[model samples]
Target: MTAPSPTPSIDTLERRFSDFATLGEALDFAATGKRGLNFHDMRGNLARSYPFSEMRSDALEMAYRLIAHGIQPTDRIALVAETGPDFAALFFGCIYAGAWPVPLPLPTSFGGKESYIDQLKVQLQSSDPKILFFPEELSEMAGEAAAQCSVEGIGWTSFADRIALKCELPVQHTDATCYLQYSSGSTRFPHGVAVTHKALLNNLSAHAHGMQLEATDRCVSWLPWYHDMGLVGCFLSVVANQVSTDYMKTEDFARRPLAWLDMISRADGSVISYSPTFGYDICARRISSQTHVSERFQLGHWRLAGNGADMIRPDVMQGFVDAFGEAGFNARAFLPSYGLAEATLAVSIMPPGEGIRVELVEESELTGMPGAPDRPKRYRAIVNCGKAVKDMTIEVRDENGAILPDRAIGKVWCTGPSLMEGYFRDPEATAACMKDGWLDTGDMGYLSDGYIYVVGRAKDMIIINGKNHWPQDIEWAVEQLPGFKSGDIAAFAITNGGEETPAVLVQCRTSDEDERTKLREQIRDKVRSVTGMNCVVELVPPRTLPRTSSGKLSRTKARNLYLSGEIQPYAVAA
Candidate 1:
């Protein structure tokens, strides 16, 4: 288990960012005066490099041409491309032109054209984007989707063609919305998180400073650009700090885990990067298959391996450190972080150079029932996502919006400059989320000694017989038992119509009859032991558990299936 580092004083954080005006200015200054930004496509066999200055100039030119082609400042445009230099150019182009850029994830060609078109239609209907800008390679896919949707216009722009256009537009004020990040919306409808130039600047400045990022650092990442962690954490942060970055295709990394390690090793990337639980598990599995040892990558120099965009698992971190300890990776490089698209990218980051800090308590005590005293237990770890970034304030509050003290688990609320102005044009939703200048994060967690510990989503909390229990607690416990994949467990509550009692649904993998019976018994026993609630354990085949594109388990969809009788519950042994 990694011990906590010395917490830096708030005064230290405040003093560090006293000079920067905004995130855009900080990035512009870095690009022009300090770190000359450079990017490489690690997956490309040709090995082409795109400099930051050239990318910025290309973005400005593209934005100017788009405007010249009748696209207005307030027009919303959709970008459909994989993670690459083209995606970055279109994103920054929108920012320069004061347009909203909605980044859509690239569809799987294997899913067939119909499935792809359906998803694109749903996004277009929801966002009502004025135009769809796509890569020429995806022109066929884009054309099919555009035909199905009611979008006003559709255009294909090649990277070479966009850069070839001539334009000189002066950078404007820092108040315009720079990016429109769509939230994961796991539980409800997705909202566009409007991040302004000023907000982006503030978040990047705070994050870079907190991580001790330098111009000499390089990043190798497989996180997708449509997501906040990939866009801001990997790409924007690299550009803002003026560092070189190498990006690999997310699908390619998924198919070949060792490709991630190979890229980091080849790039000598000092700033190793990722969302929580990804890098650790990949390295653990990949290192096991290696026959020849290579000394090119020094994992120790891979400082600031960030964990965010989801709950940080202790076992994952431990597994990573144990696997790479021989390869010169420092366990202290594991940095658990907290952020959302609502607050740009990062709200709080654990100070770099310090190892991850975690807390252990009886599972029942965390769900509002009295169980045991707070002891420093190292075995069962829940990571601390350190202190709030500079200019941000975090408060844990109850259902009635009353703030709770440290150790009391509740909804995490944040107030900061990096927070979005509001969900675009959705006043009712915005009003519901923003209260007293604090954004209701919808995540459930607690603060102890100023460090935040997340349990689960507030909406995902399961209540049985008047006691509250986080689904993650039950899911984690079940997954730890034999015969379960690392991310295969999902626990949700099913409420029958006209009945108050909501039954629990536990999703796990089992095919053997005896093993399935034993797994069922183990799941029920764990739930009863932890929450004193009897749950219906459903044994499903492998990959039955639904996941978002980024691979986070989808509890809502699983619960819906259980309620609709699409999933059958396993019988307990006599």
Candidate 2:
């Protein structure tokens, strides 16, 4: 057995910017080059170096195995995204076999086994995959979900052992669905987003163009593969753009996040990394406990630090710069982007060299809420979410679908070559969001000077007294208190005494009644400051508030559970 060394950042083969007819075509071209995907262990040591040639070869074999087992074109093949060679090979193998590959999430710490099974079962039922492939470790849980969904489940290792008859792969169409992506928020009624190879390739091309990829660029990621940002931006985009890359398992990143930084520090060339705000938040907090950041990390070469999949938090970005700037991390590397699965991967990306930029606007401008008479005006800093990617047009539309002028906060809509063909097998659901040629992003935002500033998700808005309030504003307010971290709070609207007021459920780890009471008071006062009105605040057990698979706080789920009595807040002593 030999230890693995990572692939080089630059290769001799000519670089092509994802101008391919299909993802398979993209992989075929990339395989001609020496660059490929690298997987790292928990301590940031390279465990496997999977060249694109090897990946394509393994995928061809896997495709043969699937075909020998009666897999057909357009068939949905679900595979648990494990951030390894096996899953990667199987995903591309499905594409080679003319089947639509579906990547599902591995279990998370917040959700227990049953919860995971339920989430998997819902997606399985929705996707109706011909077969579900997962790692051997998750067989117990995946098997149960497969059984419940009445779908066949097989471990990739066992499936790989099957005899694969040598045969030519099926011909693929660019318009045919290349894959099915379920949004991270897809919990109860999951809609499988169907994206064509044309759309996928187009988005990857635009993404590369947006970032202005150079031959010396390399990618580093620890995002979960189930999420669009990870699957498309980190995994597929790298191969399509013919860039070598490094990856740490999402769970490993969660446990030892600084290892992600450690890998980037050791990288010899330009490093391109992406994460949601929470990733930056976690790293910033973790580094505070460690001594001598300069001695550990060398981030001068990290070229693009992409931020997406959640609201961009300038404060968190600033905290990260505060912690690592001494170690050669430049604030200019922050590349904030806005996107969703329906748009393939990216809708808008901040141009390179532009660090975090924010604009302060009054509460009335943001939420349309009327301030108290003679009360001081309140304002919030909204982070600029960048501009639309190539071949994509963004417009803000009011509730009636009429386009709004710049800076008038409204529903954000986008139309582009990369937009998903539609939600797979759910036209009714698809029609609800698709307006003519534009995709109603279901996000509330405003456009100013050709840049977008996303306030938050529209559905997550809390309405009180005919004015709208963002739950994130309330949640962020509570997070300002000591001992609180990101994802520790969930806020939503609740009706009490026939009037709507914000209700917050905060995760309290303290068992002391006095401490819990104090925490509750602190949270209540904080929400009062943000909302300008006193609201209900409850302290629940730690991890009570649910998070989407992508690790964003799920206020909708929390509110439903609280209303249904599933989430019971602790009764603080008087």
Best by TM-score: 2
Query: What is the overall TM-score of model 1 with all chains considered together?
Result: 0.74
Off by over 4 Å in 1: 1-46, 108-112, 152-155, 158-171, 185-188, 289-297, 369-380, 461-574
Candidate 2 structure quality by residue, lDDT tens digits, 313-355? 6778899999999999999999999988889999999999998
How many steric clashes between backbone atoms does each model show?
Answer: 1, 0
Prediction RMSDs, each to the true structure: 11.1, 9.0
Highest lDDT among the candidates is held by which one?
2
Query: lDDT per residue, candidate 1, 54-130, as tens digits?
Result: 67777777777677666677678888857766777777777666677888767653435654666576666667787
* TM-scores of all candidate predictions against the true structure: 0.74, 0.83
- Model 2 scores worst on lDDT over the 10 consecutive residues at 461-470
User: Please, what's the RMSD in Å of model 2?
Assistant: 9.0
The whole-model lDDT of each prediction reads 0.67, 0.87
Where does model 2 exceed 4 Å of error? 461-573
